[model samples]
Each structure stands twice: as C-alpha cells, then as structure tokens.
Target: MGDYLKKACCLLFALTTLAAASPVFAADVLHIQPKQHDCGLVDEGVPATMTAVVENVSGRDVHVSSVKTN
Candidate 1:
C-alpha cells in the first residue's frame, strides 16, 4: 500500500515536471506544386527538368534537408 502510493506520487510529479518544462512544438504545413510540362515518352538517354514550387503556409521557417523518390 505505501509502496504503491509512493510510486504513484513520484510518477505524477515526474509527469508534471516534464509537461511544464517541455516546449510545445507546432506543426509545419507546406504546400508543393509542380509545373505543367509535356513529355512525349520517357526512354533511355532522355533529359528532363523537374520543377516544383514549394510554399510554406504554416507562417514559419521550414528547412529542406533532402529529397528522395521511391
């Protein structure tokens, strides 16, 4: 009984401290738009330019570290 009560109190205090000290991170919203282009066919030894327009609607600074395709 006493052990359980002590554990619960310690857990509660730890949670409260963490919540008060931690900073709330806001979500970042970004919009990506691609330009229109016409390509007849994709074949070997073909050159293409991929253009994208990225917009930050979150009103915050966004860092683009890297980009990859699957």
Candidate 2:
C-alpha cells in the first residue's frame, strides 16, 4: 500500500511538471499566394499548371495525404 501510494504521487508530480514546462503549439495554416486563378483561353481538355509554394510555419512539418482543386 505504501509503495503504491508513493508511485502514484510520483506519477502525479511528473505529469504536473511536464504540463507546466511544456510549450503549447498552435494549429498550422495554409497560405496561398495567388488566391485566384485565371484560365485565359485555355482549352477545356488541355492540362493547366501553376506554381505553388507550400510551407508550414507552425514549428512542425505537416503531412499532406492528398490535394484536390475544383
């Protein structure tokens, strides 16, 4: 019983310390430079291309599974 109480106290102390010392992180946001697209006389069946610069300024690398444009 004494050992269990000691272990529980230690665990609680460790968790509290971690919660207080750790830094909080915010959600990442996507920034699109051109926010607009203009297809000037392009064929409907032809493929159009655009340059994109995607970055994560949220102090972490974001994993992207898929992207779709409509």
Candidate 3:
C-alpha cells in the first residue's frame, strides 16, 4: 500500500512536470497579440506587421533577438 502511494505520487509529479514544460505552459506565461489566424489571401510586394506581447514574470530583463513569419 505504501509503495503504491509512492508510485502514484511520482507519476503525478512526472505528469505535472511534463505539462509545465509544454507549449500550453508557455502560452500561459506569455500573451501574444494579433493571435495567429489563417491568412486568407496574399499578393506580392505587400507589407504587414505583427507584434508579440511577452510578460517578464521573472522580474529580470529579457532580450528578444528576432522575429520571423512564414
């Protein structure tokens, strides 16, 4: 019984850790504006801009090197 409880606790911890490491966790940590949506149409020589909002929950300065689009 004791060993079973220990195994269950370990499994729970592992699952929690995996969830925390997934993209869902990052989405919760950072909020990006202009939420991704399918591009309906496109043409050449057209210009567009996108922005991402990131929160610094760590209270430390963070640097963003670059941003790209497909």
- Measured on C-alpha atoms, candidate 1 has an lDDT of 0.65
List, residue by residue over 18-68, the lDDT tens digit for candidate 3.
987897755655444453445445567886544454555655454657766
Off by over 4 Å in 2: 1-44
> What value of lDDT does candidate 2 attain over all alpha carbons?
0.64
Q: Once superposed on the true structure, which residue ranges of model 1 sit more than 4 Å away at CA? A: 1-43
Candidate 2's displacement at residue 13, Å, is 41
Q: Write the per-residue lDDT of candidate 1 for residues 13-62, one digit (tens) a residue.
A: 99998887664432224444454545556678886545555556556667
Question: How would the candidate models be sorted by TM-score, starting from the highest?
Answer: 3, 1, 2
Ten contiguous residues with the weakest lDDT in model 1: 23-32
CA-only RMSD, every prediction: 9.1, 10.6, 8.4
* Candidate 2 C-alpha lDDT tens digits along 1-70: 9999999999999999888766342122443344455555667798876545555545545676776888
